[model samples]
Target: MSTTTAPAAGTSTTGGPFSWTDDGAAVTVTLDGVQVLTYTYAANDPQEESPRPYFHPVRTRTGDLVSAYRPHDHVWHKGIAWSLPHLGPDNFWGGPSYRRGQDYRWLPNNGAMRHRELGQATDDDGTFRFAHSLQWVTQQGSLVVEEERSFQVVPGTDSSYTLVFDTAMTNVSGEPIHIGSPTTEGRENAGYGGLFWRGPRSFAGGSIIGPGGATGEELRGQRAPWLSFVGQHDETCRFSTLVMVDDPGSEHPEPEWFARSEPFACMGPAPFFSQEVLFEAGTTLHYRYGVVIADGQSDAQRSEALALAARELLAATQGRNGQ
Candidate 1:
């Protein structure tokens, strides 16, 4: 379930500020000797529920937890995860499967993405690179898709850092796969899917800012190259900002970002959204996103700059391959 690796030559092996460690079930990243994030792949529930890989307890450099996991209201909502509410007949997004006329209902068609391999690669400067191979399988153990997901962590000043999520998936079911969200199945503006982040309770009053100065519900279901959600922890009164930059090279360049300020803090760029995307057999789809987490309140100008920088970086690194 887990693998350990010795730091390569010229790399610090004394529990430095940025490092990766695997403990069979999850790979954790630590900053300045404090845990910042954990990528968990192990399935720890019945019916194979909550089996998808996710980042939990994402923290600021100062050690403030910014992400939440398995909240009572939405047990299937993990901390930070990549999922689709509607993937053909399989529910990889957890909870109930949405049907066209039947609405949302618990179904045995819930699938799980099993982590197959974990590997680390060397990176320059203060960045770390790693990857994961996962299989999307149905409850009956039927294969639907295979994904190669990678992450690059770039540490910034103080508790600020950038986490890049690069994912490449191929349809291995010998048939076309239809990807969509709950909105496509009649849920209205609830078109949430893809890379999702759930913030802590303290982030309830956070402001969702997007490119061009869009905020709050106005930013939802709208296309944006990047978006930022800033809020403070109710208990700690400490502010934090989370910025997501969409890769212009992605198949869905202008993805409609799903942002929320009430109920709970959550947002992400939903590609399929209200529409459906078909992944033909033998075809691969690639997506790239940049996430910047910092300890501070939401600043429109600064967040816009951060998003632009992230977008440029993703464009340069991914090039045309991400398209």
Candidate 2:
């Protein structure tokens, strides 16, 4: 990874409504002096199972933390992370691996996705952009896959902001890599993998709104272009909204989403749910997603509007890429 001098404490610069500070281990983004997000790549705990890059304490514009990291119940879940439960013969989603008929079992095949390279951070037209190169290695330190991920943070309205996550991965083990979720291995309706998000305990009983007006557990196992979870952060009723939109250009444009409310809020857009996607040797696969963090409740109408906007943005980006 590249090395740079850590910025002094409390020393941050502003560009429009965004401010950021890099302390070598992580990059924190703030809005109007209020922290909104932190991208941690260095010094991650391997004991947590999947030592990978993740975004934690993702806060709304109003300063409410909507993202949770290393929750006691599911220590493997580290806020917003892109993970897969079953990757060929290795487990990268952490915890126990689900067997075909024997059910979940503890295995030593757990792997770690380590950050290997970091690109120079740049600010372009008020947007912050960065790139990362990571390697997925098993416990025995054998390479399974390599990924190039890019992140773009755009300042939105006073109450919201947008993050664009794009990843391109290649099979580096000289063999086919099979990507799947728990559901594909025998579990029913437990197709949770890929870009996952864990919410705070205060978000229990929160409402989940999707493009089809579905809510709560009913939203699980359903295909949707976008989904939003709105909840009160505390007794004071501080509302926060988290919206995730699947890119139409991705492998699975209409991916099934997994959502939960009890035992703490959590959700994910599982593209490889109930099935497996094979990545041939030396071949690459790309995926893109958009996340919106807002400081208010998102009703069905608002959620639909946001979804439409996200689709348009993705379409435009893809068009430019093709040109």
Candidate 3:
């Protein structure tokens, strides 16, 4: 993989509402001098976990940690990651491979999305945007896909901020590859993948909000444009909200959502929830999502408003990129 020089540790500069510090392995973004989130491109996770880039310690503007990392139940469950469970015979989501008849088992099919090089970056106009080039390689050292991923942190109200994530992957393997989740492999309701988020332990039993005034785990496998989770913090007992919106212009406009609040609080727009998407050789797939992290609990109306704001931000970004 090609390498590039990373900014020196402690190197920081202020833009409009954001300032970022690069500590060699990660970039920590702060709003008004208070840390909000840290994106780690050089994660040192074990190969079995399919080491990949992730965002951890994601906090609301008020400093309440909403993201989790390396939790006991699922060590592979990072804070917020662009993870995929089944990529043909490879397991890019880490953990055990869910077989058709064998159930979950550790296989030699784990893959990693290794960072290749840094791309364009802009920290101005109350926003911070960056891109990265990555390689999706299987455990056997075979290249499967080349990806260009970009992230944008945009200014929002005092209680919230918007994070836009975009990924374009080109199949480089000679044969067709199928991307799917556990449900597609016969395991029921386990379709958890694609820009997944793992909430803090305290978030268990949190409230869920979706489009159309929907709520609860029943929203799982249901098509939705956006979803939000409201959870209370540990000590402060204050509430926070996380809203995720799937770009309507994506290949899968309104994807089925994989959400949970019982055992744990987690959610994501599962593009390949019930079926597998086949990518022929040399083909490309692109997806974009927007997330809003806010300090207070968001009711159905508030959640929808936040989702709309995120959608608007995403649309503006897409227009700028000529997508």
Local distance difference test values of all predictions, in order: 0.79, 0.79, 0.87
lDDT of 3 by residue, 1-323 (tens): 56664454332245376667776567888876678889888777898999999999898888999999999999999999999989999999999999999999999988999888877556756677767888999999999999988888876974899888888899999899999999999999888889999999999999999988989999999998899999999999999999999886675657999999989999999998999999899988999999899998888999999999898788777844312
For candidate 1, give the lDDT: 0.79
lDDT by residue (238-284, candidate 2, tens digit) is 88888899987775558999899886898878988877888899998
TM-score of each: 0.91, 0.92, 0.96
Clashes of each: 5, 0, 0
The prediction achieving the highest lDDT against the true structure is 3
Q: How many backbone clashes does candidate 3 have?
A: 0
lDDT of 1 by residue, 1-323 (tens): 44343233223344335666666777677766667787776656555353788889798888888898888878888888998878887888888877778887888877888877765544445566667678888888899898888887777653588888988899999999899998888888889989999998878878998877767778889988889999887767879999998887766658988889888899998998878898899899988899988888767888887787777777766742221
Error of 3 at 280 (Å): 1.2
Candidate 1 local Cα displacement, residue 252, angstroms:
2.5
- Error at 214, model 3, angstroms: 0.8
| Highest TM-score against the true fold, candidate | 3
Which 10-residue window in model 1 sums to the lowest lDDT?
3-12
